[model samples]
Target: MKVLLIGPAGSGKSLLTRSLGEWLRRGGYSVALVNLDPACGYLPYKPDFDIRSFYDIRKIMRKEKLGPNAAVIRVHELLSNNLEKILPELKIERDFILIDTSGQMELFVFRETGPKIVEALKDAVGIFLVDATLMNPIDLVTLKLMAQVVRLRLNVPVVPVITKVDLVPEINFANSAQLTREIRKQKGSVVDLALALNKSLDGFDIPVRVIKISSKTCEGFGELLSTLYETYCECGDLT
Candidate 1:
């Protein structure tokens, strides 16, 4: 089973990738962690297969006379074109495979590269990280919007997670419907967009769970593990 970790920068996906891999390994499951960030300067855990081995955006920027933004775009386009090459490195069989994505959300998810990566993986579920300490009406609405984008664009199951729960006393994931109603009652273009996304998602009954986890305290990792295993089993990815 493959689990894709995606979110904005500083969303703790790297930490969660390391933590979840340890949890799975402790449970007697083989785990392989993949770092899909070509430009990552540092990673907390060593990856089994890192995109840097194939393409490092920083090196390309220096050698090809490209700017930071252009270098990232070109690198993603390269990854998209050479996705087949990545397959050979990812052929190791494991009970769980955790994918740590790039921090460039738009370059990865909002574009063609995200879907291409998802299509390359079998029975993979996305874990979208939302910073718990930054939860507000606007942030929540924006998160819902991005989450919908992942579901619609990638056409796979997405689990919305709240990272850094150690900083917050409580995080609410169940109130999204009510939050949408409140947003609709208000008058604004952003709220209007949020309301529309809520309605569209409601019709599809897409399961967007709000999991609160903290790598500091190991909070909610157990629930996350159970949930992931259940999801994989439901996908008929049984060993």
Candidate 2:
């Protein structure tokens, strides 16, 4: 299965990509890593397919005389246009294909390139990482909303994962009711907004399964792998 690791900057998407890929390989599963971030300087694991070979953001800035933001936009534009070139490489047979996206999440997730790439991959599942350190009830609600938006855009199954759990004391709430109660304790209009948003999200199949993982300790790798397997097969076969 093709799994896309997507999240905001500093959300540990790349680190999770490395950790998850390593975990899968150790289980004797064939895994392929694809780096789609042209702007990323370093990665823990070398990608089997790297977008920098096709278009580098820094080089685009230097050659095209564009600013960093403009370079990022331009590189993604190039990627969208050149999907045919990249798609072939991604189509190689493997037990798992892990794709690490750009740190500039909005540029990718909110734009056309992300959906286009996900559509091309067919059965790709998105792993939306949220930094656990930012997991106050209000912030968690907002991040959950963002993950829904990502699912809507990508039109695929998405798993919301809390990353960097080691940095946080503990996840505050187990369910939406607990989350709402915690949100009610906070002050300001933002709390009201979070509460209303949380209510509006009711009845929709939002990801409620908590998969808190720490790439540092490999705390939840087994659960993550199992979740992915369940997504891939209704029978939840890991074999």
Candidate 3:
């Protein structure tokens, strides 16, 4: 079983990947933590395999004289061609493999290289983490649209996870619907924001299972695993 934790900057992908690795290990499952983020300078947990060993984004930036964004694109393009080699290094004799992805969602998600990289994994599920405390109503709308884009782009099982719920426990699946009602009754600036979002929401049809998680307190951690089991894993598999 392979689980890829993905999110924007400050969305706790690395932390959750580390925590879940520990959680699964405690449950008697052998877990291998793989860091797929070439841009990660420091990691809280030492991964069993790290992509920085092969591709260094900083080195690419300095050697090629490319900006951060351009360097990321270059590295990803190289990985897309070298996935056959990279996939072997990531493989290990473990029941569960936790993959920590780049914080830059578009650098991997929007590009063709992103899906190809994910396709290299065997039995992998993508976890999309959203920072609950930082998201506004408009951000929530954009997330829904993004969920659709990611799902369609990757053609994989994408799970929507709302992280850091301890900071703001009010946002979740209901917030999206509640915000829709609130905005319908608003005008001026609020209505203007809604109009802007409506254009982006044109073709959003992805079904999102928004589960809240607090890594600090481990609140909702069990529920998150349960949902993963029900949605992605076989019976009694990856439990």
Using lDDT, give the best candidate's number: 2
Q: Model 2, range 1-239, lDDT digits (tens) per residue?
A: 88999999999989888888888899999999999888888898989989888886777899999987678778888877888887787787999999999888887888887788778778887788989987888887777687678888988767778889899857867478888899999998898899888887755644345577999989988988887666656423323
Model 3 stretches astray by more than 4 angstroms: 172-207, 233-239
TM-scores of the models, in the order given: 0.85, 0.90, 0.82
Across 33-76, the per-residue lDDT of candidate 1 in tens digits comes to 99987777899898998888888787899999998767877877
Best-to-worst order by lDDT is: 2, 1, 3
Q: Model 1, residue 74: what's the lDDT?
A: 80
lDDT of candidates 1 onward, in order = 0.77, 0.81, 0.76
Give the least accurate 10-residue stretch of model 1, judged by summed lDDT: 230-239
Model 3 residue 108 CA deviation in Å: 0.4
The 10-residue segment with the lowest total lDDT in model 3: 230-239
- Of the candidates numbered 2 and 3, which has the greater lDDT value? 2
Those runs of model 1 whose alpha carbons end farther than 4 Å from true positions after fitting are 173-200, 230-239
- Between 1 and 3, whose lDDT is larger? 1
**CA lDDT, candidate 3, residue 145:** 58
The candidate that achieves the highest TM-score relative to the unseen native structure:
2
